[model samples]
Target: MEDRNNNNNEIYALIIGAGISGIVLARLLAEKNQKVLIIEKRNNIGGNCYDYIDKNGINIHKYGPHIFRTDNGKIWQFLSRFTAWHEYKHKVRAIIEGKEIPIPVNFTSIDTLFDTTKAKVFKEKLISKYGKNEKVPILELKKTDDKDLRELAAFIYEKVFYHYTLKQWDLKPEELAGDALARVPVYTSYYDGYFTEKYQAIPQNGYTKMFENILNHPNIKVQLNTDFKDLKNTKYKYLFYSGPIDEYFNYRLGALPYRSLNFEFKTLPQKQFQSVAVVNYTSKEPFTRITEFKHFFNQKIGQTTVAYEYPAAFELNKNERYYPIPKQENEQLYKKYLQLAEKEKNIYFIGRLGEYKYYSMQSAIAAIFELVKKIAT
Candidate 1:
């Protein structure tokens, strides 16, 4: 529970971004009686998971909607220390063939899409082949040669995942690695929740307040609008960098590929905009989905805030890098950066941007926990 440990020669660890990875590592180091300084490029912290109460009295995620869900007890317990959580179950529906149906195209979604007899038959066939209540990847479903399964797969792929993938990543399924297609899965049950993790909820107050609580320790010093390059000449015993890994070494080998996003916010006078928190347009819509922010916490407010998500290619100094493109070439290029990072004992690459992987919020926290455990040992 100690804040600032004054015995570490005045300079202990310098953490390069005040995002979840940075903050968690800073708090861990601070607890170990080490002083930590955090520098952030933007005026605020929290990285892509940042959320705040907007001017219209609605909590809006500056990035897209980030619903916290994880099966790891360690990650949940670590985050629970900072803030109370809203135990809200999130359900996502997609507008397909002019009907709003549950995503992953569950049994209910199938019923909604097909006629009664056909839906029942398809359900029976799916159960006979894969068993009930099992989650199957769309590609796996397409692997079947049964005409009925083929029809079912075609419908779901064309209406649920295919166009959506194209819109979200701007790449066909064939172009990317096999793991990329696993992002979307088909549920063989009536379950409608977007996530199947053991724990799923949102921070009660908002992400910002929770982050503030974590970084409030006297040992953790935070400086806003601070660039890492400006403080490059300054030295610390340890530097946990959570910024882009390639950018850290000035893209010495080559710039790793990434996907950014453009978020558009709208405040409507009505209490609710959509039935569900998120509604995906699986068609060739320019924008992917619309999120009604209030649903995250079930906030009782007169007006509702909604955000439209548009995926864009990551450009230098343009949009924020949200996702690392998971392809063979990109992974190979990242490995090259990893080799470079291995040589720098003073700097440790941390988090999504730094590691060049799409680590979920909980995943990032867990990774930080492991990193600090190693430091402690």
Candidate 2:
């Protein structure tokens, strides 16, 4: 745990991870004239959102495809400083019953899936009950007594939600939180984009490039492939941790549950593969979805790269924690860790792993923004 080599750079804070949270904290602190040192366990920055141009000159996400979308103008503005934006609205399709349909079960999906009379009946019924341009939750849709509506909900549950949820979380639909499933909005129109956020785009360059720009400040120094445990004895004015909350405490109270994913990337000698960027296989397949990377930024290349995602149990040493398991048991365990974290005087826990919550890219930055505000005052 040696101090940073530069004598001129007096470090004020030490950040455990170089992911978005840690980078955001470092940048915010550096702006306030506080020198920061970031320690990253990985070889590079951007965390799971990392992407690079492949051997075939096609941009590919190493983990999985990430299409940045956020409604927050502040986050958009902050990120804009690092990388120019590529205006790309992402659309995803689900392969169910051998038919590719738009997800969120839109009006177009209903028309494509059912017979003319039946589809019309459904469209009329849905609009009449929920009103036009409304996003009705699947849970609310399932609770209806109407035979057509219940059948529609049941179809969505079985074809869209059931097998996919089972494959993704290793849990049945009932075992998970209602909000997790309820969060899937059923669109009443032909809008095909995955998100309804005001601002949605990918970086003109890759995420790694953007991260490199973010950490390129004079007051900030990054040490890659350095774990937090390596610097346990080192001291600073404050410590910002973005790793697992339970792991920080050495799991004395037991490890918090999380879901992990295994990605299989393939480089094929074809120009195109799937119709869209992402194709969800909502069936009893071992892999949940396959993503064609070129479709994301509309890369013009002869060969394309695709990734197959398989969800698995989060083994401590085997796989990375992709998602915090959203259930009562896990929440209770996280709260215990939170309570422990609260007693510490100068340590701040940020990001998905530290907070033990599922957060989007924007939400993670927003978390850091809130923490920065609190620390500044």
Tens digit of per-residue lDDT, candidate 2, span 189-266:
778888889998989988889988988898888999888887766657788999999999999899999899999998
- Model 1: C-alpha RMSD to truth? 2.2
**Stretches of model 2 off by over 4 angstroms after superposition:** 1-9
| Residue lDDT tens for model 1, 252-330 | 9989989888988888899999998899988988999999988877778889989899999999988788889878899
lDDT of 1: 0.87
The alpha-carbon root-mean-square deviation between model 2 and the true structure, to one decimal in Å, is 2.9
